[model samples]
Target: MEVVRSSIVLSRGRSRLTVTGVLTGLLLTLSVPAALPESGAVTPERGSAYMGMGVLAHDGIARGATADSLPDSRTGQTEGVDVSSYQRDVAWSTLYGSGVRWAYTKATEGTSYKNAYFTQQYTGSYDVGIVRGAYHFATPDSTGGAAQADYFVNHGGGWSADGKTLPGVLDIEWNPYGGDCYGKSKSQMVTWIRDFLNRYKARTGRAAVIYTATNWWTQCTGNYSGFGATNPLWIARYASTPGTLPAGWAYYTMWQYTSTGKTVGDHDRFNGGTTQLKTFASG
Candidate 1:
């Protein structure tokens, strides 16, 4: 994480995120307040943010025994999907009918890397009325954190919401650059996260989400209390059951329980619950 300063303004309608600070190259988060509900529409909670919007800032480094399984519903409308360039060809209408109420599409990475489907997915998800967010995969060795943040804010497009825009996330998973980029060294990583968050907050007027895998949480990112209350978390763990994570880990709003998800509009990806979605939409 790099070092920067910022403030956030949450929307209470439309569930979109916005910002007003200098954009950087690192991945980050943004939020908004949902507007009061109208007929046939859901209203977002005033000044409330969803926990599932949190993104894992790194790859899976979780070890040891998994927790006991929690009762999970196989079919529902609130649960969402994550798609990338590979799945661009999939029809968006299939997702709308399949109960995908929300979605996050991969936008871009580095100078040359871009998710081919982001443009279509962003518009398609909005048209279908599914809450949508964007994410960028960041590497410690590749572009600097600020650079990645700039790419995301500039290319990831805009957010519109009363509670929050789909969270801007930094996917800190596998590092294409070997060495410490994937090994132990919290100082630089934490600095990178903080920097990204600060720059994004300054530019977006909202807190940014951090996405990462369970294994990476323990291996790289430890208890980062500095994130404060505004930051939400998204945890990725491919497991048989979903519940509390490790003792050091806090409660996540969204849990990616499975990667090989059999969803209507998505390929193999993490699947999780959206129990509080209505709450986030309530005024």
Candidate 2:
């Protein structure tokens, strides 16, 4: 989620370096491959982390979800959170004591970046009896979906048959980059998404959860209706109600209600009870 940047400077005979020298130095510095973060180091970007207030404002909701209560009216809703390296040193036991029953941590982004804290966060959550899941932030414009899926699975996005582990989630929401659709046409976007879902299902033997906002889905993929029957929808809507879902999904499996929740990370709720959540994870 973070982008690493490097800077270089040069000097000549007690004077500042010339433009040519500076440019040469810049080129040389850029040529050296940027080192990825060391284990437990923070990545440069935490996607959607800082956008919580804006999203909630767009929905006309002044207050974000609190740990004191569920975000929705649904009975038996299970509380959860999704975390990345931005959330440092989480108290998993405290979260569990506060009724957080599950967690999904960022495992990989695009095809190259892996969350440095994935191991600790995932294990810590599971150790405290929280159903744990891994998620990948999609960058369809960067590479083919199948390739990214391979990268995700090979890194840490794969699922096991453990009843306490949920299926991997694919975060295909608004591009933090300038282009909302990553410059891909709607059809191309849908094709890339389908490719990712198909490859992930083939590899893990379970459908991946799709995380997206209603407006982003409509704008980027023309509100594609194909994946709902196969993939569980993890809709992101920061409102009192979940509002309307994307096409083809009658109900959302998970609703991410707020990023600035009382929990240490983004707060979410499962649409069903403990048994249904366990069943979903068992897949």
Candidate 3:
């Protein structure tokens, strides 16, 4: 995971754009009607791309499409970052003035892999005045749904009344690393995800958001009917133009479309719809 950060920052300009975790006592403003970049020619920089220390991945929605060409306009929404220990030491203070209103800190992984940077990232984000939430990486190997919920509540820090800590998230993605996840079937993965959400909500009294890709929803968790309304969706797609998915995707509340996201604490991290920040925190 550490290597992924390095890969994301291929250029110095990109590095400068990353948000740091340390804040400088700035109040976050809730702005509406955000601006959309003009529909210009698609360039390599405008497309979706992901880079980690050793992970050079690209899932560009279109090879060279401009922003205005995308389906949904990312205007009038809150923009933010999802971070982990990978960018631990980065200064979070920079986010305050960098157009970031919300952040999601990785709190745990599986049932036992606690993120070492949770305290720093979570508190740091809060201190900087950015509305933030805690997230967990889902895995089938652990004690499963209910068990994972226990780990998150007990170890991932309690939720906040202001909803800053958020209802939490379940990151279900393909693991290329050495594990039972080398190539887990989509159905099997969705079953485990639902189990985890069921237990997580039961324990926290809050709905858990699903952070996944368009492909994941269509291929693995196609039955949006099963996930239900209370379960908010956080869709991740690396596309130049943004748009809504199918009806089953109506539950979606956030969309992550950029990876060259440079902020104060996080350099070359993932970025998403600004509306998500407002909706998650109801700010």
Candidate 3 wrongly placed segments (more than 4 Å): 1-61, 65-74, 178-187, 222-224, 243-247, 261-279
**Model 1 stretches astray by more than 4 angstroms:** 1-77, 162-164, 180-184, 243-249, 261-283
- Per-residue error for 91 in candidate 1, Å, reads 1.7
Give the TM-score comparing model 1 with the true structure, all chains together: 0.64
Question: What is the model-wide C-alpha lDDT for candidate 3?
Answer: 0.53
Q: Give residue 243's lDDT in candidate 3 (0 to 100).
A: 49
Ranking by lDDT: 2, 3, 1
Write down the TM-score of every candidate: 0.64, 0.77, 0.68
Task: For candidate 3, write residues 198-252 as lDDT tens digits.
Answer: 7777776777877765544555555445674567777665454334553354645
Task: Tell me the deviation in Å of residue 35 in model 3.
Answer: 34
Positional deviation of 13 in candidate 2, in angstroms?
39
The better-scoring model by TM-score among 2 and 3 is 2
Candidate 1, residues 1-283, lDDT tens digits: the string is: 1222243222222132322221111111222222233365443322121212222112221233222231135443255667665454546666666555677777766534667667887778767666677777665565567777777788883444543346577666534334424444677777887777777777666566666655555556664555636666666653444444533336665555433211222211223345355344221
lDDT, candidate 2, 1-283, per-residue tens: 2232333221110011111111101210111111223465333353432223223323323245322332445477888888876665688987887678999988887877887788888999999999999998887878999999999999889999999999988888655443567789999999999999999999999999998888788888898898888899988775567888999899999988755422277678998898999998997
